[model samples]
Target: MRRIAVPWGVLALWVAVLALAGPFAGKLGDVQHNRAVDYLPASADSTQVAKIQDRLPGGETTELVLVYHREGGLSSADRAAAAEQVADIDRKLSLVRTPEGVPSRSGDTVMYPVASTGPGQDEKARDAFVNDVRDLAHDTGAGLSVDVGGPGALATDASEVYQSLDGPLLYTTVAVVALLLILIYRSPFLWLVPLAVAGVADFLSMGVAYGLNQAFGTTISGQSQGVMTILVFGAGTDYALLIVARYREELRRFERPYDAMRAALRGCGPAVLASSATVAAGLLCLLAADLNSSRGMGPLGAVGVLCALVAMLTLLPAVLVLLGRRVFWPLVPAFGSRPKERRSLFTAMGSSAGRRPLTVLGVGAVLLGALALGAFALPGSLKQEDSFTDRPDSVVAMRTLAAAYPEASSQPITVIAPTGKATEAVATARDTDGVTDVTRGRSGSGWTEINVVAKAAPQTAAETATIEALRDGLDGRGAYVGGPSAEQLDLKDTNARDRLVVVPIVLAAVLLILVVLLRSLVAPLLLLAAVVAVWGAALGIGGLVFGPLFGFEGTDPGLGLLSFVFLVALGVDYGIFLMHRMREEVLGGAPTGAAALTALRTTGAVIASAGLVLAATFAVLTSMPLVQLVELGFVIAVGVLLDTFLVRTYLVTSASYALGRKVWWPGPLSRRLPGAPAAPPAEEPALTRTP
Candidate 1:
């Protein structure tokens, strides 16, 4: 396969354009429109409803509660200082004027609305506000606690967490990539090339993500940002490593550097392309999800993977062609040495398992089945308050609210009935099961606001049931319930829609890619089956660890869905790597058992090493402070390990051995095409080798 310079240039240009356009891209528009609509009161007439919405607080403004304690409740001095600090912060924040004006009030307890001015305009204002508040509380001799229970606070806390993780994540990713390259190549210059490619890939991916956000009006949350960074680094490095490793091996067979590069591309390009396609397709499946975050993540992540692949195939090779043998300087080579035949541990395992494919397959099936026992038992609730670290101001405030006014801690449900009908609706709703109180508010043209207070947390089962009951009771009466609890109900409904839509889409995409690459319907089906099993097992394990083992009462309802997406995408890596080796062995004319052995010995080491790196990179998320990060980190890490060790090693080997030559049946794609040599090609002469 020849390298195309034009495509490479075009890709570079496209990346440049995205970079230039980055700042102009507007923030991700809200994808949760239904959630907002669900919160409107049912009693208001259409016109009044619109007017009320117009006067309501902007979506960005959130009511924040700052809490502090002194020995004898709140001392006068402490109250005075805290009040002043709140006022100053409010004044400074006033510069960030949103569509809905900031409401300010002062007394023993200060209350105000904080507006988000995007990432632009006084970037340091929020930080400064937080610091100033903390300092004042300290100076006043009060045990300070700031509870930010508003949307703005959530955004602020998320940003802080990402910023905190960014530095360490970057450093760790780079260090890990460099270490891997150094071990693989032993040449400093050669090792640096792939890192450089990965860096470029990162910049290009981020630029594209920014542009996509602009074009599609999708919001890129803090979680997405952090995951994108780690993914770009890890995936880019892995792709580059595979290409470079193949290049070195090919160079051992050819006299010319260009020939070696071509040879490597011919052997590795198809595999890399296939692998990239599977992952990208898997990510693209997120488009089917109802959540804006999930849907946006799919395309953004796919773009990142595509950029990495382009760099690996084009830029890296072009640089290698230019550098020639000098790329591996300080190394000298001797000609005519016998080609080394590495031991195949995977092949041995494959052969042994091949003789017992059913047993191996059955074992894997049982393990996954057992793990999946926890699937139905998994809890599904959104604990936004606990999403952040307990130490965060928002979390603290939420906790305090839960203690002081449990009823008010959750979002208020606004039940709307026609102005004249609100009294009857309010009276009926107030008496409804699960409702703690129902307060009637200003009524307009045939509409009234009936505030329905729930007896449980907004995200709890009881609240959801209550919301449903209220909606059912007021059906066709222009009744609309809007508030935080209603929003949760909408989110839950949306998530359910996503699960139904995304899983099949991803599965089909992955299967299609595998079929095209492997040229065997049977193999793709089996591989997909393995991936599904691994995904289920991962979720089950996560449920056990987080749900029961760790005693985490809160639920990350989206965890299972997210795990499915990630495992299907990433788990394919091991399968592709191993299967490619098996094909190569077959092309070399090894008998079924011998070929499997050869594949295991030669490719097994690389897969194991790569899996280790990938798993470790994912495992780093455990150190992050947020619950989502920790859960995501553990699930992906464990899933990758299972894919690498159990599914790829034992299960695949067993199947391949059991099928023997039949594994490649029904397609000439497995056979070398016209003009391609059948026997193992002669080893290329080494251009250079380091002692």
Candidate 2:
């Protein structure tokens, strides 16, 4: 009765958890934003400009360009229609100034720059304004078309993609993981238990993330939230796999399900805890990053992993115990039953690696190094207009304007200056090289706004030079230079800086955790080296695929850093599982060579299954609309597969076999065991029972 009470009590507590977390889980979407300012650091010039704009008379401006274009040239009727549409927009919306259509040199396109502050910083209102203007800017079927593009329109399109990601991303991830689980367990009922627990963990993570936002003002973005969901399912299912595999083994030895569960926890719980700690610690290192998105992602990711850990350890065990051995269905392990054993694939791999360890290690290193060289083939940093996989109205308008007005920018460079120095600032900006025109407008809270136009197109090197020149010309004059282009510049630069700072921290954090867990210096370094090589190889593969195959024009700025953190942290998990099991065998009086092979034979299937589940979950991101998400997902998914099938299976195992007991250098396991063989056996004996 007492034993039964514990499981029921756990269920009751989880029910209570769901009740508390359900409300906040849905609220997470409310707090998520993908705004430019959200991605920027507080100290960035663009961020400061945005803050000041929010304090201006009407609020931050929603700028747009209504592009009217024709394949040949605009006729009198086309011009008239464009003019009437512009007038209609001006009448319906509160514009900062009366927009005048500027004709392209080609005579095929006319763009009217629209600016309004009425929507302020409200995303919904701003989106409504953009949509309403789009409704007003009608396309005439006879080769005359209209589009609304600008910073405002681009932001709305991005928001829509992000908002759309929540449902599809979650559903797709769940479906992928569910399918993988079903295939792995091959049981009608077994797959549902972990999937349901993962679902609960995801909800719990969302609530905790929302709480973090409310309490600490953590910035939440669609990207970070989506990653959080992936981690919950991927990592949670991994933990479940390890626990269930162990429990199944224990069930054959122990009569009671509760006793079997206790034994299972005793066997694999430390490795699970250590791996989770490693992931959380590595992700927490992102707090040192200068980018708010990266920093906030640190806590959100750590929260996700930790929540998954708790649910897998507590709730999953409780539910499994309640369901008993029946959960295994046709494959149920009966008490005192010795199961038949067949030669496994990992057994063959271990034997081959053991026979020619050096050859295996050398060849694997060469292959990974060769793959790493492909990094040079990767595309340049992604541009804002090229961010989406499917071009939106904003992207179309920007492209049309770029082709039509090749010599000038349709986007404005926004500057905020002290009201006292507004005139001087304007003169400085106008005199700066690359400046085509300057207009002064808006004054409030002691700040004056100036809009500058450059001779070059948006996000190009020439326009970047102009923005730099404006900053250089206006520096220390109590003015801040910013705009969409400036914000992109800041994002690129900040991500580069963040990589420098966060990468080292992540490395040190994960290495330290490994050293502590393994109680050895050499093993930790070996594992870190293997995972880092995996990262480089994974990125190199990305370079090969992203441009040549996927035709992605640009790489996301944050990809390298984010992918490194995830790959290293998550990749080390398989190493920990393998090494931990090997250490257990070594402690149980097995020779070093025999232990390595046995560990591979025991843990390889579980690790491979976990890797597939994780890789598949991340692969779901490839279907997302944004190129950034797709790139990130592709690289990570590829990395996990490489780690699982190659690095863990071949390189690390080979290295361990070659190193012998010395793999545990300085630890007690490093010492020669009593009566152990002087060297590892040339071939290992086949086991009689399932490991």
Candidate 3:
């Protein structure tokens, strides 16, 4: 165990250097790509490509569209008043330019477009502008209604929500964890220990995440940032609690603190390592996702769990070694005291389960299978618009636009044709299947801009096929389709490629970790298989629940990635806890059935408790504004509960008992160590009770 420190130190140093170097190295690839795409020309064949390309707005600009209405046609007075207020607000805002185009007024309504010219523009300026306009609208209360929408307004709202919620979420999580620890341990210092370990682990994990982003050019999204904080705090504290709980139990038997720590580590180390590996593997499965945002979360989460493991095994032990018995303080006398002889509920449950393993296992399997019936109902559509908060101004604006001009919600597809071929291209696009409208711009710079409107939403497969057909209609004669629809097609293609490359790599990594921890070829395979089944069940159930029950049209792309990673990682945690305890019982010379029963009796309650806490914490994500978060939270919470209770407690126990001692066969680790005394016979009471 001491030898593990050398590699750990080196990894920590590497992560530190990476974290420091990452931000400056253009590590935020997505941000950079966004800038580049904004600056680049639409394609050589665009009719006004040259003029518009050079005049394109900078990437930082925030487009603001204000919609206002009055009872009578916007009287000259109303229009003039609104225009003056907008101009005044624009003048006061840094980096803001009057929208290049003029305000357009129609009967009883007016529209104003505003743009920010630079990245350093203060968001407060937008807030102030909205506030002023809102006040003006209120002054004309009877006749006027005002609503602001655009990238700027949406950005402001999102930023405010995040800023407001982040601190409260952190404090709430910490408070909850602290209270839970204090209640469980009944020792102030001991309760604080997990928090201390978690804090260190979080620092190190974030540093490593920053480093990975630098080295790999990964982009961490807002969602990942939120999840990372929660995972680090929650999982880190959970791991520490597991270790400390065992340490306290050991202290009741050992005379010296050092002995207690060492014994606790030896007994608990394998379990901790296994649990971490499973979690890391599960999260790493996200690497298989098509979305880079989803893929990035995998390694980011894995790094966090790994850091927590290192801190628990090293930093935590070092602290305990220094603190000695004083770590328990006023609780010292309780350490050596005996527990009551009453039968615990957990033990009774285990006894019932053991007596009718088939019935318990059968019922669990049936329930999961029933939920999984919804799998076929899952929709694969990934529309970005559905991801927003239900009441967001952007969504409201979109709905309004959709109502005003039903087809306005549809995106125009850009079909670029070689110079001098504008007329022919427009004709060809209009003739193509599924094409509803084809408008050709006046020839400019010898090139053409052909806009093709689709009958269906551009992101749908029908529209994608239409685009492909139009591109094919143009042949190889230098026509490129590039628009929102085309970009979505490209995104889909990229995601498909990513999914193929990532899933296998993540699975391999998970398998390797399992094999290394279990040191048994058979057990790793079975555990991985069980995890896969649980993952399938989770996704299937999530699909059904979200699709039919909740009326979500399609699964959030991020949800699938999140589900895959969480199911694998969290499922592994339960597997490790159960399997490790089973191994311990076997080592105590208990027969297969008794060993399985004892393992369940001892570890089942803790695993169930941990799973419930994690599930509840994750379930809180449903309260977030975004639909994606809600779906993700629900899926992960359900998956964790499934893994902890059904898979870990029943499925795993059944498999292990069925395997018996053969589960440990073909491994030197399973055999009695040479020159070491044999373990006591199975008939002897294994544990030495403190009482």
Candidate 4:
């Protein structure tokens, strides 16, 4: 009765917590900050510009361009409609500066720069303003197309794409997991257990993430929040697979379901704990990042992982135990029945690997190296306007403006000069190379806003040089240069800097954790090196295909850092699973080669299933509209599959065989057997599998 009470009590506690968490969890999406400033480096020049601009006279002004065009030429009606829309907008919103039409050389497109201070510094208000403008700018027909576009509109569009991700991403992820779970379990009833638990864990994580946001003022970006969801399902499902696999094995050993569950948790719980800890710790390292989105992702992702871990280890087990062996349905493991004896695929893989370990290693190394060359062919940094895979009205309008205003800058360069040096700063900026024009604008506190236009297009190398020159020219004048172009420049430069700072920290942290868990320098380093290779190979594949195949002209700036964090963290997870089992066998007195093969044979199916589930969950992101998410999803999914099959099966297993006990080096497992063996009778391994 007490045992029954405890299980029911655990479920009740979870239900109570979920009830409390539901509202806060729902609010998480509301708190997501997807503004350009939200994603920028905290101390970047553009970030400073954005912050300063928000405090100026009109608040962060919404800069937009109202584009109206016809395929052949602007008809009389088209021209009148364009004028009428601009007039309506003028009456509808507060203008920072009155708009005037600029026509293209071909006379096919006409654009009007509409700057306004109506939205103030509120992101929601700003988004609403963009939405309202877009609605008003909608075409009235007769071969005329109108798009309300600019930085604010772009931000709004991007946010909408991100917001759209919530429903599709969750539904797709759940469906994918459910389908995979059914196939893996081969039991209609069994699949729902882990899937349901993962869903609950996701809910709990959202609430905790919201709390963390309130307490720490963490920057909750849509991407960060999205990653938390992936972790809940991906990492959560991985833990579930390991637990359930071990539970099934224990069920065959122990007579009672409760006893089986206890034994199973005792067997695999440490590995699960250690793996989750490594992942959490790896994710937590992102707090050191300078980018708000990247930095915020760390804690939020760790929270998701931790939530999933707790739910899977406790709640999932309780549910499974209460359901008993019949939950497995037709495939249920009865206490007295032994699984069919057959030569497993992993056993054959091990035999091939053991025969030519070095050859396999050499081949794998060459393959990884070849794949890494694709990085050089990757496209340039993704421009803000080209960030979306499917071009929205904002992108289309921006593109039109770019073509129409080819000789002049489509975006302004914002400079904040101290009030004392405002005159000299304005004069210096006007004289700077590539400065097409300069205008002195809003002033408050100790600073004045100076808007400048460059001859080069935004995010181009020429503009980058122009920006660099302006900074150099204004060095001692108390001026900071920023705008859309400047923000992009800062983002690109800061991403490079962060890679240098964060990569070493992540690598070092992961290494230390692996060493502590495995208790062997060689094994941990081996695992780390293998996963790193897999990451490089995966990214190379992304480089090779992202542009030519997927038609993405540019890669996301944060792709490298984010992908590294996930791959290394997740890749090492499978490594730990494989290596932990090998060590377990070795410690129990099996020879190194025998232990490696035995571990592979026993754990291979579980690892394969877990890897597939993780890979599929991540692949769901590819269906999202955002290029970055798609690229990220594709790379990680490919990497996991690679790590699971090629790396773990052939490479790690072969290396262990060739290296012998030294794979566990300096540890007691590394020592050779003390006595020469004489076969008295044929005996099977104590831990043979069912099927």
Best by lDDT: 2
Tell me the tens digit of each residue's lDDT in model 2 across 403-432. Answer: 999999999999999999999999999899
lDDT per residue as tens, model 4, 141-213: 8788898887888988998888888989999999999999888888889889999999999999999999999
* Model 3 segments more than 4 A misplaced: 1-143, 150-165, 285-290, 326-342, 376-382, 410-501, 519-522, 540-554, 658-691
Residue 563 of model 2: what lDDT? 95
Clashes of each: 30, 0, 6, 0
Q: Which ten residues in a row have the lowest lDDT in candidate 3?
A: 32-41
How far residue 55's Cα lies from its native spot in candidate 4, in Å, is 1.3
TM-scores for every predicted model: 0.79, 0.97, 0.76, 0.96
Ranking of models by TM-score: 2, 4, 1, 3
**Model 3 steric clash pairs:** 73-108, 74-108, 282-568, 282-569, 288-502, 288-503
Global lDDT scores for all candidate models: 0.64, 0.90, 0.62, 0.86
Could you give me the TM-score of model 2 versus the true structure?
0.97
**What TM-score would candidate 4 get against the native?**
0.96
lDDT of 1 at 403: 54
Model 3 lDDT at residue 361: 66
- Which digits, one per residue and each the tens of the lDDT, describe model 3 over residues 1-691? 5434544565466457546645543332232222112212233222223233223333224555566566546676777777766666666664344543222333655556555544423445545554454454333445665666544555555555554555555566677677766766677788787777776676666666666766786556556655776677767766676677667677778876667777888777767776787787767766555455666677777887787788778777767756777877766634566545656555676666677767776776777777777667777755544555456665455344334333322346766666577677888898999888887643344456566877765366777788788878987666767654465455555555655676666567777777776667777777777777776687788777776777676666445555766767677776777766666666565665677777777776667666766776677677676666778878888888878777877776766666666666666435654345546532211222111
